[model samples]
Target: MNRRLFPLFAAALALTVAASPASAAAPADAYADEVVAYRAEKWQSAHFDDAEKAQKHAATLKKLGCEVKTGAHGGHTDVSHRCPEWREISLKTHEKAHQWEDWLKANGFETRHAH
Candidate 1:
């Protein structure tokens, strides 16, 4: 951890990230679309920082003709949308976010959600 080599390490990391195929494959909008699809199919849910963002995401789902259901409280901030077709793969009473993806995949759907 020499101070003089910090810049070199950062530059290398930057270059590595820049050259990643995942970074070049799809734009944010495309990923957003995938997330939207997952939500539509009830494969996942999203939690935004504010009500506005939640509503906005809900609006996107609506625009796509999704039938989103908000909590009984009427979307104060935390909204959970359910897809009737959703079949739970498995339930993890306590698991980290990283592990959830694989668990979900093994269950059935191939999806990811935005946090």
Candidate 2:
């Protein structure tokens, strides 16, 4: 009985060792894929000196299918926008921000951190 159980235990240990690498690799592969996807994202951010301009920018980004939010950055009002579905939609949001930036500048509102 002891001899038979020894072989069974050894086999189970061997199997566990053999499966370890594959199980570990799955999460690493998933994290790598997530990193690649995040790197490929086209998220845009802009800073406005005036809260009103940031609000306008946020509204424009919302029209372009982006989820927009406002925050304070370096004592300036900041607006960030992202379209999670596709880069094309985010591109439209970015383009609209550029247009808004140009309009803001023309209207004498200085913009910063437009990236």
Candidate 3:
């Protein structure tokens, strides 16, 4: 820790960082802002902060006959799931849509018939 050598050490550290910017960020927030949208559609999704929880949710969605797509977004997973849309059911009847909404809500999903 000599005073005269401090400047040289600081200059070397700066050069090392400037030489490898990507490596410098690799250990930090590399994927913190990354979000890969599986599809361009405006689909409602389930969010899971843990990988295990995401996988379990995916499993249950699959069991519920939902076609799901899960993408890892930084520290969390976003699941795009759809069993049926409100438009797919008979809007004239509205019975199936209500029933579907109830089923989704019962399964812990926030549902709305705003299709």
Q: What digit string (tens of lDDT, one per residue) describes model 3 on residues 38-83?
A: 1112445767677776676666455444578999978899877765
Instruction: For residue 39, give model 2's deviation from the true position in Å.
Output: 14
What ranges in model 1 sit over 4 Å off? 1-39, 72-76, 82-115
List model 2 lDDT by residue over 25-93, tens digit each. 323222111111111124566767777756666664454345677898787887776554421111123
Q: lDDT at 4 for candidate 1? A: 38
Q: Per-residue lDDT of 6-45 in model 1, one digit per residue for the tens? A: 2433333233211111223333322122121122345345
Model 1, global lDDT: 0.36
Best by TM-score: 3
Worst 10 residues of 1 by lDDT: 30-39
Worst 10 residues of 3 by lDDT: 31-40
Superposition TM-score, candidate 1 onto the true structure: 0.31
Report lDDT (CA) for all predictions: 0.36, 0.40, 0.43
Winning model by lDDT: 3
Give me the runs in candidate 2 sitting further than 4 Å from their true place. 1-40, 87-115
